[model samples]
Target: MPLLRNALTCSLLALVSHIATAAEAPAPVQSLRPLLTTLNERLNIGDLVALTKWDSGKPIQDSPREAQVIASARTLAGEHKLDPEDVAQLIAAQMEANKLVQYGLLAQWQAAGHAPDTPRPDLAKQIRPQLDELQNRLLRQYADVAPYRRDPNCPVWLAKARQGLTHDALHDLALTRATGELCIRAAGV
Candidate 1:
């Protein structure tokens, strides 16, 4: 009987210790939420971009624009004290995600024979500025969570942090693309 009680006490103490450790563990999900939010916002703008392209009969793949954006991101990364290559990758992921959304929406509209009758914002005059502002916010938030990029659970945290931010399957996929560069596995891990 004494042995049974001693074993039970040990088990209970072990469980309590595990619970405490889990409770104190760093929450990478929370830290990454702001960056995800900004990315989602950027993804949402893909709708506007799609609408503009649909009406103008413009192609979605704009190489010059992509190059410009990447250059700007690298410059901004320097200001943020982050790796320029990494930031460029992140920004490129965002653009790819945005393009995914644009492609999806354009396809839908093409099949329907008409685009949605929504107010169209000027891509250069209005939308670009909004995106530029988001870029700044995204870099700031990225700086905050940059340390967590090496966390083993970053992908898990990113998956959790993305919940409820997307409106449809396309956006979900876009979000997935946007976060592709967010977490890098550590060396030999």
Candidate 2:
């Protein structure tokens, strides 16, 4: 009975230690969550952009603006010590995702014959400034999580972090598109 009790106590201690170790294990996914959150915020802005376009009859595809954004991202990437091309790709993915949301929402509104009755901010004055601010925040966040981009579990972390951010399929798709460039697997892997 004494020997059996000692064995059980040892097993319990080992189990507790294992659990603690696992709990303390680094969570790269959690570390990347702030960047995901900022990205989601950027995506959500697409709804407002859609509304502005719907009201003003402005087209969704703004080539010059997209180019400017990519340029800004490239410049900011240098400041953040991130690769310029990689940052450009990331920003481009984000723009594509935003356009996806805008296109989807515009289509729905067009089919319904009217857009949602919401206050529309001026795209040039208000919206662009807001986006610029978000761009800076996003670049900073991207810098912080840049190291985790090459982690093997990056996709898993991204998917898990993205959960519950959007309920609808369109936004979900946009989120997926936005995060497309986040994880980069090494060559031959």
- TM-score (all chains, Cα) for each model: 0.85, 0.85
lDDT of each prediction vs. the true structure? 0.93, 0.91
lDDT of 2: 0.91
Candidate 2 local lDDT, 1-189, one digit each (tens): 999999999999999999999798657777778888888899999999999999889899999999999999999998899899988998999999999999999999989999999999999999999899999999998888887888888888889989988869999999999999899898998
Colliding residue pairs in candidate 1: none
The worst-scoring run of ten residues by lDDT in candidate 1 lies at 22-31
RMSD (Cα, Å) of model 1: 5.8
- Let me know the TM-score candidate 1 reaches against the reference structure: 0.85
Off by over 4 Å in 1: 1-26, 187-189
Rate residue 106 of model 2 by lDDT. Answer: 93
In model 2, the runs with Cα more than 4 Å from the true position are 1-26
Residue-level lDDT of model 1, residues 127-184, one tens digit each, is: 9999999999999999989888888988899999999999999999999999988888
Q: Please report the TM-score between candidate 2 and the true structure.
A: 0.85
